[model samples]
Target: MSKGKDSPAKDGKRKSKFSDAADSPKKSKKASTSANAAASSSTSKAGSGQATLSVKGSGSSFKQLSKSGAAFASFADYNPAPSTKFSIYRADGLPDETGASTNDTDERLLLAGETDTMAYVGNNFEFGSSSEARGYTGHYMVGVYDPSSSSVTLRAVPTFQVARSIKANSSLSSISSKRTFADYGEMTAARRALGDAFGNRKQKANARNQDRMKVDTANMEVILDDFTGGIQDNLASLPSLDEVLASSTSSRPMPPANLDAKHPAEAYRISDLIPSEIFKSLPIQKLIDNVSDPEALKELLPYSKDFPAWIWSRLVDNLQRSSHLSGGSGGKKHTTFDEDEDEAASVTNAEDVMMMPALGATEDKEDAKTKVRIAYYMSLLWYIQSRPKSVSQRGKLITALKLDGEDANKRIVKAILGTFTETPANSDRAVMSAFHQTKVLAYMCALALHLDNFSVDHDKLARNCNIPPATLRELFRTLGCTASVVGGEKRMVLKTPFTLPQPRKGKAGGRK
Candidate 1:
């Protein structure tokens, strides 16, 4: 007889209350004991267009009920925060069901009011297979463990097909947002595999994060140990960081020298970040000719700080003005205007780039590296903006840029974004080579979002990418733009500035 909270919403009529855990004084203490309960999982029969998710507490202290709204947040939590505290994203590449998610900025109509504790498993649920559907599900696949009891169980029926799931694509997500991890062991493994990233710097400080629970989706059930008494013993038993770092030191390559140093090229013109080849293209040349103030775009990118307003304005102007050029392959004959443009950006053949001497100087190597870093970033920006969605995913586009960052580029690029395999790699690395290009894209995207300014237009991003944005949002999060709205209308805010760790004070200095 209940309208919605206890009963399912039938038509477009009624929706349930979006509930939060309001624990009583006695239950609050009891909730802490259950926080680390060893959790297991089992999938029920999932037929076409129908599913049921049930969470039952095995603890005698807890009651058996059909819908215990208060019991939802009694367990664990995630950083990227799943749609429902009890919800399971299970897989990595699921579609963004903002309707069933806890999105404050969501503009979708859902079966029921969604929150951290509840979601809908009714008819009319839809997720598709497009480039839009493949990347960043905007959902972090994680399972919470109940620490108060011996174990808890999470069950779900499947609705969507498995999209592209790069289980090892750990670098492309938040510290807690991994591919598919159910329990504490898997969660810990996922964290270490996250390797290095700016996103990992600030972890969500919650005692729940420290709580241990078993979450294994592959198997129907996970039998976790009795971790209620003390998980600290388990944590202490784990390998030390110093031991891990020392072991990885031999495998880890040396870092680059001076990344922020001024290059001889800066004396010529700071905007020379663009590569020599194809820089003479009329469209590219327009950036300089049409600019009112050079200083607007003069900051020279790859810096996570807020960029000049003019920089993004010029970039948008160029992209919007050149929509026809989005898919154009370079063979078009140039007009007379191209000849009179910046001489430094003269169009060069592949041979020229190859023969471009590895500029000499023990005194000038840092500058050379800096110049390379800048040029690669510029080249990547131009490539992504001017290219089509198909090419963007493929490794060939990045290969064509051919601008190497020497030693530091890889490390810097990795720090910014671990990997972006727009396309599949054969035997070598994954679509990861695209990390350099993605790092450049992330920098530009975050920079456009001024600190003083809260949001940046999403449709403009779609226009710039030459395709409606989807999983690339993960790249944005990897750098600094933590949260984004689900739909394309609202602006994506840049709350945190993307920053790299300052070099330790102890390191030896280079020749001044």
Candidate 2:
């Protein structure tokens, strides 16, 4: 009735305007077309025969498809159906609607335009046992249920097998093996006893006992007060100071024959500054012999500075003369052959000379003698180096070698290095030998200068020098170097003079 009241044309125009205001025809058409295209694309993908289903992570042998996405299967192959259910099953052949599902649930529903993931727990089965026993082996099948078709389609089929967890042989061996637990208790008891015997508590107890014993031993019966009291009592009972002085004078030994009976100072000479005991202990002949003997020379080298100037001079002179004698006199050679003849003769003579046993033997003997002399010279050099510069005789020898001056140590080092390159002769051989023997000594001196004052392990130093420990000990004694056992090892204590200032005595008789 209302439509009739208004004009049909006007009503139609109003409806058209309202519709236009609500939405444009062109926009509506485009939106509808786009949505339809998406639905069609999804349907096309689902219907494509190229879609396949696959399973992954089966075993090491199936590693080719184990990686993620490598064995991924799309649900596109399954035709769209209402209330479609997906199920997984294990089957030997092609799975069908009759096939039993491996999954616990009957089916999984996947909604339209939506995705759902289903996780299924695998059935527990023996892995290695015989089929008759418990294990099973076969392929896994994924089935797709179609309610419209009332049938199941085998979407994916992956092979699988069951294996026994425990081996038959291992099980049987375990059953047959025997073990004893009776010793366990005894072992535990013994361990406890041992722990009690040597544990921290016992160690602490022993330490405490040792401390108590030390304290008991250290506790002296005579204190300072008691000692002073005893001394006073003894003084009261003893003779006076005058009587003691008279007794000491009467008991003294007679003066020496060389000393004046009335005045001993008049007979005293500067030479007497060195005690006669030193000469007595080390005789002149013995000193000369030691210098010549290699073994004895090693012993005397450390005490070289202690020997008198005359003794040092005699030693050097003897070594020089001996070296000269050992090495025959030096003279110019007069060759009978000219250059060409000499060359030819030398070539022919080399083989003949080698063939002559007597000549070879004589050469070897001379070489040995040369080595002995070289060793002797080395010992002499080592001795001279050990001597103090204040010793005029040692200084004279040093000057003669042209090795004197402020940098004496450096000059000596250079001379030592040169000896190795220079031809072996009287003086040169002596110098080289000395360098070889005293190389370690020189190194020690340099180290001492670096450290200023240091202590060295006696054994370690001997080993470093390639000298015997006994020889090193003798050397230490000869050099007036004191060796004392420190930290359970013998050490050479080198004290640098004037390193520390002497303490002054205060007016009150206290050290300042």
Candidate 3:
């Protein structure tokens, strides 16, 4: 999504270990050279003459007018080089009648010799972008360029409007206008601070009639209708089934052949994406029970929300070398809750001490503390989930003291879909270069979470993510939607529901 490069880190950002899916603000690159810098350079070259320069903005889309064959056909071909060498004075150049009352050519000032000292910088000197140049000075730089070009041309120099000194001509009078301010309908601070979500409840009578987006929002309405003779939806195009049946009495509708007798599909929940074996294998629960400070995690809940749900999955990876989770066989050992808790208590003092030697990795004592903190955070979430159910008449979730109050079994899921795992390139297990970064994967996962019924246009998402339409279509198909094009816009439509991969019941590493 960063155009094959990593986004630059933002300053003063609160980064955490639980942020494998969090998006970091990227520093935008700005052009270094500006008109002020150019002006200074030109002034130094002029040696007190103060070389005048003005940039005029021009629309490059004017080339479409060439279809009429009437614009700029008589003008000579202009050289499109970056920089050109020329003397200060030239006889054949456009006449410079600026700052003069006479229209005579002899009155124009011209300088000869020292052609090497005066190099006219062509339009492309500042990466061929006129907007950046214009931004440095609050003025447009106009000149002939290809479709999107804007530069100072030799012809425009004669008409350049240089800034002139302003002198006071009259004394000011202490007068005030009769009208003060107009009554514009603007929001008050209290009302504006409440935002659009305040008191926005919809009546049952105005319930949505459609389930999915049928077309791109910019191109057409969600429900396309026509009223040539009478108001009708797209279904009006099809002939009635009764009319077809009446046309031929002998023709009967064929019954569906359910010879195979396939069973119905099971409903999939958001929790099924990650394997349960991972939670069982990890000893985070043990850390929660044995750690002394449960309040630390309670305080960290707000910060932990900075990360997406998938970030919890990365704990397993970041703690690969932690003494708490590591075992003798390089695999986690199965133990009862009490046994793990006792073991956790024994290592409480060693949380700050590195029990294992570092094998060229940063994971050590700090990771041990991290593992405990993660458990504490998980315990806090469990505590929040275990609260008594409350029907709040006012306020919202994520508000102060607000609670979901449901059965507490929200096991976090590792990102198996739209996630990347790197391996040796030639080992035949390497994941191809795709949406591999943390922010991009999280962005895509958020999109997945927003989809309810299907049939979605991801043009805006694809453009923002820097993904090609075809590539996004394939990704959508991989994410459970059938890729399609409705009204020239790519859409993802769900027919048969997609199910995440899970092991059979009663099997090892299966969800029990």
Could you report the Cα RMSD, in angstroms, for every candidate shown?
37.4, 30.7, 37.6
| Reference-based TM-score, model 2 | 0.20
Tell me, by lDDT, which candidate is best.
2
* Candidate of highest TM-score: 1
TM-score of each model, in listed order: 0.21, 0.20, 0.17
In the range 1-512, model 1's lDDT, one tens digit per residue, is 11323322111112111011111212244553443221112113222222222232322222222232222211123222254223322122334644334433222211222344333332112443221332522221112223232222231111222112233553567655655546676877577555333234445332235444535556443323444335767787877887886565323221111234353221122232232332222123333333344444333332222322233433433322233233333222222111212321343334322111121222132332332333334435544444434243233433343324444333333322232233344633333343444444554454333211335454455454443466445544443344556334455554322333333475468545
User: Which tens-of-lDDT digit does each residue in 1-512 have in candidate 3?
Assistant: 11113211111012111121111111112211243254334433432211223222223222232222111111123332335322233222433345433432221212222122232222211322222433431222122321111111211121111111112311222222332343122333344345433534352222222223334467344234333334444567766896775554223111111123221111222223223443343335433442334344334343233332222222222233344444332433222111122343343332233222212223344544443333323333322222212102112222322223322222221122112234454553433233233323332432232221245465544443344667655555444456677657666654443432232358677666
Better-scoring candidate (TM-score), 2 or 3: 2
Instruction: Report the lDDT of model 2 for residue 446.
Output: 24
Evaluate all candidate structures by whole-model CA lDDT and list the values in order. Answer: 0.33, 0.35, 0.31
Model 1 weakest 10-residue run by lDDT: 12-21
Per-residue CA lDDT of candidate 2, range 1-512, in tens?
Answer: 11224433233333222222112212344554553354334433332122211112222212222222111223423422344342333222324467744443222211122113322222212232122222333323333433332222222222223112223355676554643465676776686667667768876576567657855435365576688899999989998897886676333221111223222212212123222332132223333444446456535343333332222232333333334334443321212111222232244232322211111122233432322332333333444444423223334554543333545334443443432223444443223234333443433322221121234465654443345778666444333346666557666553322121223557885556
Task: Determine which window of 10 residues in candidate 2 has minimal summed lDDT.
Answer: 352-361
Clashing pairs in 3: 55-140, 55-141, 56-140, 56-141, 56-142, 57-140, 57-141
